[model samples]
Target: MWKYLKIVLALCGFILNTMILHTNPINDVTNLISIIEKLRPLHKKLGKPGPHDWLAHHHEPGQTFQEYYKSNPMTPRGKRCVIYIQPLGEFTQVQRRIVVLTSDFMSRFYNLQVKVQKDIPLSVIPNKARRRHPEWGVEQILTSYILNDILKPKLPADAAAYIALTISDLWPGRGWNFVFGQASLRERVGVWSIYRNGNPAESENSFRLCLLRTIKTAVHEIGHMFSMSHCVKYECCMCGSNHREEADRRPLWFCPECMAKVCWATCSDPVDRYQILAEFCEEHGFNNEKEFYKKSIAKLES
Candidate 1:
């Protein structure tokens, strides 16, 4: 049964990859394996994890978390994260994707790095960013074209950085927050895209907010690289947002519990992650989300 279940997880991962145009190098994965093991021993002793155990992780389930654990499929450390981002040029729609990425990272406390690579023309990619951020006109988002293509991976100079690339049409998501990364902490990470925001003859502030959201989205997705989850304390930027309005509702911070979870997830210190995020946010002026959003709209319109 345990072996069969492992097959299920692997198959599921493969199917998901095909659907999203995403890939997991360790087609033979690990994170899920290790987690199941560590928890299984105690799970049986304590009845096992809640019904929600298989809830968001896979979108599908097979045998059981405990069953897999007893079987001992893999180790504690592995990169189970794998994200596929569609293009949105550089506006609100793009921001939505990033938000989804960030929220997912916080929820799991996993390191999922996101990056951008030019792909199809913004015009070709649809534009949901405009619908949400009407303030930004369409002209700005309807940037020049490349083709109906995937983003080319661009590795950063720093050894600490890596890259992944892809491009999808507008309105990308069937889940709350998902990401792409190697199961092993040792692997370098990255993701990027060129998605369209909307289709407006004129540009506006709403368009700019759309752009701001895209930046936020990238930041959120990249946060996954560190293995962090949604903050329970204060409104977490990692918290899921279904609409543009909700996107503005959360603050960017990992709750205390989530912070602890990330530490365990990445085998790193939580404070260290927090410090990195805080500093990055401050540097990019992500602290002024509202202002930035508003500015995005204004900028695009001009």
Candidate 2:
């Protein structure tokens, strides 16, 4: 039964990838294979997804390095070198600090400059775009409106991608309760809410946890903007997430396959990137995360 299920899932993934990616087939993939091979031993293989996990529910074929290269994926180059973060609403001092830290970390992660834009008042979201959840009664903001109407129009000419960060809760549309965030591959615009990241002012641990979550979401969304698909091959930041618990379970680092894409997309040096990432994690008390990055760097340098 499990073997048959695996075949069915593989077929579903192939079909979905063909439909959505739509890039010319790649050939002479030797270099790509070499890169994946070199980094493979440094990463962990993904276990089967749980019954309610993202992969269990949605079939997605992970993108290969050559496929991404041939897809005319958005790379940071020329004028499109800056990542712009648009502030959507007011935030507490701690929340504001989280936003600032997120921007800084994003700059280092993608090796692209990041700029936080002037704050856009929450009042800009009209009654039509705001809601109160019927059951939970939590105030929510419409994600589509922000992506299409707000950020798209105002996206900077020099932006590699424009992202919005907000304190207000987010709901994608009808039939959903809430979302941590959402992004557009074609539009170069995305938005995420830190409302669900937990209040940072509560305690030191909570603050660190909130920062880690925010950084993960920020970088993951931007990865999508680069036309990188969910990673099916390993436990990775690019893997699709089904819920908060599942997302938290995923690491803050990219798997070998996804790392290759990021390195290629940003034209970054893998060793240097790992070193800086480790330093950031260590400074913020993410000891385990710090050690993992350090190990990756050592393996790469060796």
Candidate 3:
């Protein structure tokens, strides 16, 4: 009798952990499913990768909604609803403007409060963590230090994710030449650089491109901080990239699976998110992005 009772109790525990853990209430899940279905047509189904694309170079199994839920991904709630951005170096006037715009966009993207902390000088980076590229000669800072030592320790009590944005280039450790950015998902900390985002002062087009690239990387890294992994199922913003060309090939929007993760985590309304994004893109003359968002809204409403 004791052995039979123990087996029954174990089965009940397993069922609850798999089905109920990390999921919203039954009604909320139903509503999210309905929203995802309506917004489906606005997003293209990913077909095949090009010769030099991320999927061609890397093998990722991709994370589905079920996998994400089982992972117990972090969500914004109560006091932990703020996203914080820490500036680590000097910025040109245009670069500064890009930072300002990105902060504003982030707030709307995740439906959370975004706070830009006071600027911290690059001088704070120790000499050991600073290096010059062997051939390119461009100076680079260590990304791990910023993530582990700086942002993690300084993370705010109310922060959902703490991100550091710097104008300087970054390299993760000793293996690579340089990296665009790096983030630790479990730690809820990350860092990115605008150095390779293109020179915003070059031309009007350059400025716009720089801004778009910066926003893409910023949000992508933040997505990781939410425990979202590289998107293998679609050509979404959550897709991993090995190089600039590959990254640029992906759309600035989330695919259905990845979109569900974000909306679930943030408790955001998909229609409202699309409307705000459309408005922001339109105001910034991001016509292509703006049109996509508008179409997403249309699909949801229709």
Candidate 4:
């Protein structure tokens, strides 16, 4: 377990253990779904995508740069192939994969129509705040929010939600893991991680945790869009984030109460979704997904 950190740190250049939440008997899945819905942007408020937009991104780990481009086109080359360089910051090969994978999961489960483009070039914005922020990077949109915040009060909320919708990280506020951008009536979300130490390489469980959290971040932020606040249902996804530590300590399960709302947003039933989600979790090795889901079911006493 300890050795794995070397790889993660070497890759992203940073590695740290955030809080970990343990799920007790699931009581209110409905409460969870409600929170995810609240994080979404107004459906119509989203920006339109260009045909040239990339579907998503993934940096090939343990593969040569040439090999990486081969599987993933270096330009708007293939069907959904769009090469991303450091549009506003640098992304190691592995970290790149994290973005692509997380984006794909959200895009698929949510049936989102947004494109996943990568490597926009760190110099694109030319803003000092973006270029120099230690917590945030050039790629993340927080710098833009800072500039746009005064002109609008709720700009930060929307911006945080948007990034939360698509990228990885909880970005609750101060020490919030995620970075966000806001506009007139909508917000944009982005991820910004600084590499200083090293990254995880082994421990598939760790990687899966990161991936699962990515999905939660998407759902949690989306909850903000739907007018729901954090769920107080025993450390659930919508519990609201004041920092990354709290975000990590959150269990990625929904209570019965929240599940009711998620079904409405995606237009599906919680029972049905949980059944499918369990299998998905098994395929992906997410025990918590399966464990917490049991809480939503009406158990037959022995």
Clashes of each: 70, 0, 0, 65
What is candidate 1's TM-score against the reference? 0.35
Per-residue alpha-carbon lDDT of candidate 4 for residues 184-281, written as tens digits (9 for 90 to 100): 21233333332211243456666676666555665555544433444543345655444445456556654333444444334344455556566566
- Per-candidate TM-scores read 0.35, 0.87, 0.88, 0.50
Give the per-residue lDDT of model 3 (tens digit) for 1-302.
99999989878875665444235453166676777678766677677887866678778888986688668787665457899999999877888899999998898888899999989999999998899999999999999889987898899998989999999999987768777778887888999889888999999999988988899899999999998889886678888877888777778788877887887788777888889988899999899999988888778777
- The per-residue C-alpha lDDT of model 4 at residue 208 equals 73
lDDT (tens digit, per residue) of candidate 2 on 58-175? 8998887778877888766555789999988987889889989998889889989999899999999999999999999999999999999999889898898999999999999998
lDDT at residue 167 of model 1 (Cα atoms): 39
Residue 275 displacement (Å), model 1: 2.4
> Which prediction has the highest lDDT against the true structure?
2
What is residue 256's positional error in candidate 4, in angstroms?
3.2
lDDT of 3: 0.84
